[model samples]
Target: MPRQSAGILLYRKTNNELEVLLVHPGGPFFVKKDLGSWTIPKGEYDDSEEALAAAQREFEEEIGSPVTGTFLPLGTIRQKGGKVIQAWAVEGDLDADAIVSNTFELAWPPKSGKVETYPEVDKAVWFSVAEAKTRINEKQAELIDRLVALVV
Candidate 1:
């Protein structure tokens, strides 16, 4: 079976404009990537676990704070690699500049013997729906459309 991941897309309204929270990945591979590199705070899950619970867990893991709100299901999308992502839209807010993400160790320079530690998410930002569509993974952009249909 293909890998399955779950995540929560946090959104809030300010100045009568809707904004969604998106996270930029850390590590050298993504260091220079900007557009089409951001994504919902998400992680993988298996058959034994529930998708919603995993989404909540991943959100807290990546954002360093637990999230609770009325979760509006945005359904699923398949990425270019065939990994499936299940996402939900929740009305909420978070301090983009103050986020603290969990860390992971990766072997740097490919076959080099050096290892480096990096945060799972280097930064988080809230963007208007129009802007988020450009920042988030292209395949996952559909989640934004679903959110607009459900709440706008």
Candidate 2:
């Protein structure tokens, strides 16, 4: 079975323009990458766990804040690598600069005997739907499109 993940697409409207929050992955592999490297704050979950609850947990783990409100289901999308992502759209706002992401330890420098700690999400930004399309993974862009269709 393909891996399943869940996430929340946090969005806000400013002066009638809609914007979504996208997070940049941390660690050496993504340090220099930009376009197509951003994504909704998500993580893998087991079948025994509820997707929506897992999505909320992952959001708090990655964004350092708990999200509460009505969630508009954006449904699911299969990524190129066969990871299916279940997402929801929530109307919310947060300080992009104040995000405190959880950290992961990985062996850096290839064979270096040292493990380094890095934030799961290096940073987050609010982008207009058009801008998010360019920054987010191509497959995940569908979530943004779904949100646009619902809100606009």
Candidate 3:
């Protein structure tokens, strides 16, 4: 079975323009990546748990804030690696600069036998729909379009 993940695309209006929040993954591998690397705060889940519930849990874990509102399902997409991502769009706001992401441990330098701790998400930013389209993962860009269609 293909891996399944769930996430939330949090958005808010500013000056009558649509803006969505996107997060950058942490650690050395993603340290120098930018364009086509950002993504909605997400994590994997199993059939035992509900997708929406997992989405909310991942959102809070990655963004360090609980999200509450009507979750409009944005549907799902298959990533390049074949991991299916189930996502939703919710109208909300978050302070990108104040984000505090959870941490993970990974062996640095590949085979050095040294483990280092790093945040799951090192940065969060709000981008206009157009900007987000360029910054977000190619497969996940569909979520932004779905959000615009649902809310605009």
Candidate 4:
């Protein structure tokens, strides 16, 4: 079965520009990751859980702060990796520094007995849609386009 994830795409209008919030993945694996590495604040969920609630939970977990707003469903999209992600566009913005991501443990090097903890999302930032296209993953860029269409 394909993996399923859900998240909210947050956008805010600043200085006449629409900015979208995107997160950078954490850990050594993503150390040099930049383009195509940024992603929505999202995570996988099981069939036993509700999609919207899971989105809210994952958003909170990844970004570290609570977010509440009217969710405008952007529908589901299958990423290049075949992960089906459900997203909603909400009309609120958060300070990137407010993010308090949860941690995960992973062996830094394969076969190394040492383990290290890393934030699931190292940091988040707001970028203009034009700039966001460059920061967001290739497949996930569709959300930014769709969301712009919705709000504009």
> How much lDDT does each candidate structure score?
0.96, 0.97, 0.96, 0.91
Candidate 4: tens digits of C-alpha lDDT, residues 14-43: 888899999999999999989989998888
State how far residue 51 of model 4 sits from its true place (Å).
0.8
Clashing pairs in 2: none
Model 3: residues >4 Å from true position, as ranges? none
How does residue 11 of candidate 4 score in lDDT?
88
TM-score of 1: 0.98
lDDT of 1: 0.96
Task: Find the 10 residues in a row with the least total lDDT in model 4.
Answer: 89-98
lDDT of 1 by residue, 1-152 (tens): 99999999999999999899999999999999999999999999999999999999999999999999899999999999999999999999878999999999999988998999999999999999999999999999999999999888
Tens digits of per-residue lDDT for model 2 on 1-152?
A: 99999999999999999999999999999999999999999999998999999999999999999999999999999999999999999999999999999999998887998999999999999999999999999999999999999989
Question: Judged by lDDT relative to the true structure, which candidate is superior, 2 or 3?
Answer: 2
Once fitted onto the true fold, the runs of candidate 1 whose alpha carbons sit more than 4 angstroms away are none
Q: Which pairs clash in model 1?
A: none
Task: Output candidate 2 Cα RMSD.
Answer: 0.5
Candidate 4, residue 13: the lDDT equals 91
Give the per-residue lDDT of model 3 (tens digit) for 21-140: 999999999999999999999999999999999999999999999999999999999999999999998999878999999999999989999999999999999999999999999999
Candidate 3 residue-wise lDDT at 51: 99
- Least accurate stretch of 10 residues (summed lDDT) in model 1? 87-96
